[model samples]
Target: MPVVSRFLGIIIAMYWDDHAPPHFHAKYAEYEITVNIRTGVVEGKFPKRALRHVLEWYEIHREELIENWELCQNDESPKSIEPLE
Candidate 1:
């Protein structure tokens, strides 16, 4: 997995060959979560303590994250998260 961002203990990243439903991978030590950017859903298990920050970050950048995912899917480099309009 290639890390795209990191803050506090959270690491936001994307795998070169990720599976369907297209999402980002977040890992804080042993805790990991696959978040669905388009729908703001957590697809896998994550630590409750980390959940709040994760959701907050996702809510703030969901649209851009989805767009970045599309770019990644197209074999193009991911873009920075743009401000929500």
Candidate 2:
């Protein structure tokens, strides 16, 4: 997986080869979450305390993020994520 975005306490990434439900990974401090790119749902492991930041970022970037995720799934290059500031 390559990192798509990185900020203070969050790192977003997508695996070079992954399956569907269309998701991405977010790592914050010591916790990690896999979020569904299309639905703002946590599709996999997510510790409670780290959910807020992940959800916030997802809400802001969901559209682009899901597009990037599909590119990753297809083995095509995807545009990376940009930090807000």
Candidate 3:
């Protein structure tokens, strides 16, 4: 897994050649989740505050996330994304 963004103590990453739906993995403290890039569907858990921050960041960087996903699908190094301020 390669970390592409980190903010508010939340780490966002993606695996090389990962599964369908084009998603990214986010981990905050003991909570973690995989969020679908296109639909905002989340598959794990995060504190309400952390999840909010992650979603906000996601909205702002959705395009970058998709580009990273494509790079990951090809086993290429994903560029680091901007973190939430």
Residues 9-81 of candidate 1: C-alpha lDDT, one tens digit per residue? 8888876557678799888888888888777778677778687778887888777777778777877777654
TM-score of each: 0.81, 0.80, 0.97
Candidate 2 per-residue lDDT, tens place, 39-59, comes to 777755655646766777778
Tell me the TM-score of model 3. Answer: 0.97
Residue 53's lDDT in candidate 2: 60
lDDT of 3 by residue, 1-85 (tens): 8999998789999999798989999999999999999999988878999999999999999999999999999999999999999
Please say which candidate is ahead in lDDT: 2 or 3.
3
| Candidate 1 global TM-score | 0.81
Consecutive 10-residue window with the lowest summed lDDT within model 1: 76-85
Worst 10 residues of 3 by lDDT: 42-51
lDDT of each: 0.75, 0.77, 0.94
The residue-level lDDT of candidate 1 at 31 comes to 82
Residue 33 in model 1: lDDT: 85
The per-prediction CA RMSD against the true structure, in angstroms, equals 3.3, 2.1, 0.6
Error of 3 at 14 (Å): 0.5
List the candidate numbers ranked by TM-score, top first. 3, 1, 2
